[model samples]
Target chain A: MHMALKFVLLTLLDRERITGYDIVKTFDSAVGYFWSASHQQVYRELSKLTDQGLVNFTSVKQGDKPDKKVYRITRSGKQELQDWLHEPAKESPTKDLLLVKLLNLRADNVDVLLEELDRAIKNAQQRASVYSGIEKTYYSKTQIAALELDDLALFLALRKGITSITSHIDWLHQTSAEIKKRVANNN
Target chain B: MHMALKFVLLTLLDRERITGYDIVKTFDSAVGYFWSASHQQVYRELSKLTDQGLVNFTSVKQGDKPDKKVYRITRSGKQELQDWLHEPAKESPTKDLLLVKLLNLRADNVDVLLEELDRAIKNAQQRASVYSGIEKTYYSKTQIAALELDDLALFLALRKGITSITSHIDWLHQTSAEIKKRVANNN
Candidate 1:
């Protein structure tokens, strides 16, 4: 199960009963900047959660439109989310194939690794820029200029992502320089 | 199983056949920069791997000391490592309880939230400093400065981490200032 999705479900439950569309809208409005789930994925997860009895849904009809499903968290769902929250964090094991291929590069042409790193760095930078734009759109200079202490945590997470991506770009430049130096020395 | 332990085992296997003590030495020499495994943990893992037939060990008599067991990876072990390397990446889910409490500060004292954010910012800054040290130790002033394409990939990953932490610090400062401004305006 996706921990972030579970957390999102619990948070929605904390508020009053909401429709699937409403949950999607809320996520898009608030947590969407940090956590993203496509509408289809959200709908599918909602159904799964309902089947698991973690959530209950009631059909509501709007004028001339198909009946909409509204959801509320069950007591069991809340308990599960709480339990997960209190659990000690498991170490994140990341396997970037790019890194693996790079590790094997001494036996191959170095140009391949250089090209991949360049692409990867560009990708990271693009993501960072996109996240920055999302932050700016959500929290205006005037709005950020007026945020209360309680409201700042989300912004901080956004900043964390930005910081991480920027540092990655800087490191890429340095590493590229080092590789070039080694090649020259060998020649 | 700790994925870090697996990485350690694989790295050791990358070198020639070695005893458990030699594995520890290699870890201390190179991997210590990015990953750490206790001596006890290493020995235990080695024994477990041997029991599973993932590694073959040969008994060697030393002068006046207990017999030592030198280990080499079996074909099965290499296959297992390769399988693990090809596994899909798992998305990491992070939920900081501290942030949750801060987000709810609207129901409590604002001063508490401010103090919490201040403390958090300081902590993050300290972590960034540590990462900086790791970078200095691992990559600083190396003659082979240019990364071949593949080597560049690993460098980029490290860079991404550094950039992320630094941006986090910057976001914290901006958010703190925003909260202060809001409080002043409201008063």
Candidate 2:
């Protein structure tokens, strides 16, 4: 299955009945650590899933708030998710620009490559910091209260992101130092 | 702009001319660490890119070897790569079954989740080991040659992979301990 289908399946798996906002919020809170989907995309996917009979929606009203349309996964949706899991994962092609620039770096303009690498490392670190904060505030609280297994799984994913980012940052530091030494010797 | 396009562009950028085998080898050596592509997919993409004039190929004869068609990127290809760099990165959706199963774990089947987590951590560690080996081999050779700048960048990316994998393994260990504690308290 592609990304959109995965999101729909994940959304239903998280809760029994969730409005579109709830679905977006669920991704924001948990899956957003790794996978990101805008509200427009989520709503569009929800409509498509409903049309395909993979999910069903119920309209409910709050006292003063806007009417909420809650979605539930159908039997077919569960089957689709299972089928997807059984399929061998598609090998995703590498398309990272940082790697592209690194491969292109020659003897001439090494400084530009170094700068790009620094930028990538910093971006990764920023993302890691955000995930760390999310874990401390949300996942940690959930772990203490209900001990929900889902929250625990999400916490683990966040931990993965943090580790990945920290690794990038550390590598950046080492690489930058090495580049500086090379520049000094050359000059 | 897509995975296929990126792979083709990176392959062309690596050298002025390369056959399918050379492209595949490059992927195996470097891109495989961060991105993966199958031989079939690579060949198909090359054909598509050639048709689109993003790349050009010419058959050449080696000493007593089979004639091979080597590919080079066109000016259009460089423009495409630059355009893609300016676009915001699209985050791929996370679809880890091990995490999904863990989220649904009840007291009756906590062992299953534990086993899965154990397996996942093991796999991650194994990957980390491979990446570490590659880094060591690459750095040792490059250090002797005094190609310090390129060596530094390669080492940085390699370290990122190693650290990320180690983090996953650590998180798995901690999560397993937590699960065991919860099981004991419940009993």
Candidate 3:
């Protein structure tokens, strides 16, 4: 976790105190589409935040288990988050290995690449449906219209994921057909 | 300069024996849209490939200038590329810092976020136009129709970049409007 994930934790903490375990689960269920952090990374970042005095944890003792550390943002964390929110957005470097493969396309390898394209289209479809499931389970038309500010933010983030995957699948379909046409004509 | 960039370099070398300087230029002009590596990273990876015997270079002496190391793909490099092409494509990890920022949106700080969105839209528009210029410069309708295999692959890659930026701009417009409406209503 770096600058982005640091602020992600602060945003979550600002809303409500949560355990590291809960943060992991929350990310998988809600934020995984937009951002992801592994268990170790999250734990490590949590400690780093504590070291910087940006967050502190309280020990909550359970009946039979070890005491859990429930983390909450400090005042300085809120200030830091506010400053970051005001910073200019840049197009951060992103890698699309599929595009890299396309950049290296060759007739001899076209068949294998086509197979991979088919697999990718299927995978994108699956992801789109899964995101749709989450949208339906958590938000309805009426519910979305009436959501509070925090809920609305979450809803918008979800919408971005759904739209992106839909666009991706559409592009994949067109590209796959074009490649097949080119290869078949050559043969 | 890991598995993906390694293949990228090999792909370039497989096509022609070129200097490291030319490879850097090629990436900026053709491959930067999909994948990027710093100059240092490219040089380092080239050295690594040479050590692994996947790529070999020859020094060309100029009249008064320093010798240039022009590299070509070894037979083993071609084999490595073939193996990679056949392998299943995985969705490599990519981070969109913009999305991370969106995930952290709050009413109090949304004003700044909107400004960032505006900047992002303009930046994307500039990119879209730049890609269009490249497409026009390198490909015409009749020329595209008569293009050979390698040219077609390059054309397709350029088309992908254009389409993606268009979709991104569309989403940014809708999202910015929605965010503005939400913030206004709360105020």
Candidates' interface RMSDs, in order?
A: 6.2, 4.3, 2.3
Best-first order by DockQ: 3, 2, 1
Encode model 2's per-residue lDDT on A1-187: one tens digit a residue. Answer: 2463454454455357777787678766666654555788778888888898878888988879988888888888766765544443443333444555555555665766666666666677777778878777776654554656555566666666676567657766776676677777778
lDDT of 2 at B92: 45
For residue B116, what is the lDDT in candidate 3?
89
Question: Over the stretch B30-144, how does candidate 3's per-residue lDDT look in tens digits?
Answer: 8778767778988999999999999999999997988999899999999998888888887854456777677667766787888889999999999999999998888978787
- Classified by CAPRI criteria, candidate 1 counts as incorrect
Query: TM-score, each model?
Result: 0.60, 0.77, 0.94
Which tens-of-lDDT digit does each residue in A92-165 have in candidate 1? Answer: 22333444434434424466556666776777687777888978887787786455444565676566566656
Q: B109, model 3: CA deviation in Å?
A: 1.0
Per-model lDDT: 0.63, 0.65, 0.82
DockQ of predicted candidate 2: 0.30
> In candidate 3, which residue pairs get closer than 3 Å at backbone N, Cα or C atoms, i.e. clash?
none
Candidate 1: misplaced stretches above 4 Å?
A: A1-8, A15-33, A36-69, A73-109, A135-140, A146-156, B1-12, B15-116, B132-163
- How high is the TM-score of chain B in model 1? 0.65
| Worst-scoring 10-residue span by lDDT in model 1 chain B | B88-97
Mind giving the per-residue lDDT tens digits that candidate 3 earns over A1-187? 2477888888788889999899999877776777677889899999999999999999999989988999999999989987877878656654577876776677777888889889999999998999899899889887876877667777877787877788888888988998888877876
After best superposition, candidate 1 residue A7: deviation in angstroms?
4.1
Task: Flag regions of model 3 displaced more than 4 Å.
Answer: none
> Where does candidate 2 chain A have its weakest 10-residue lDDT segment?
A85-94
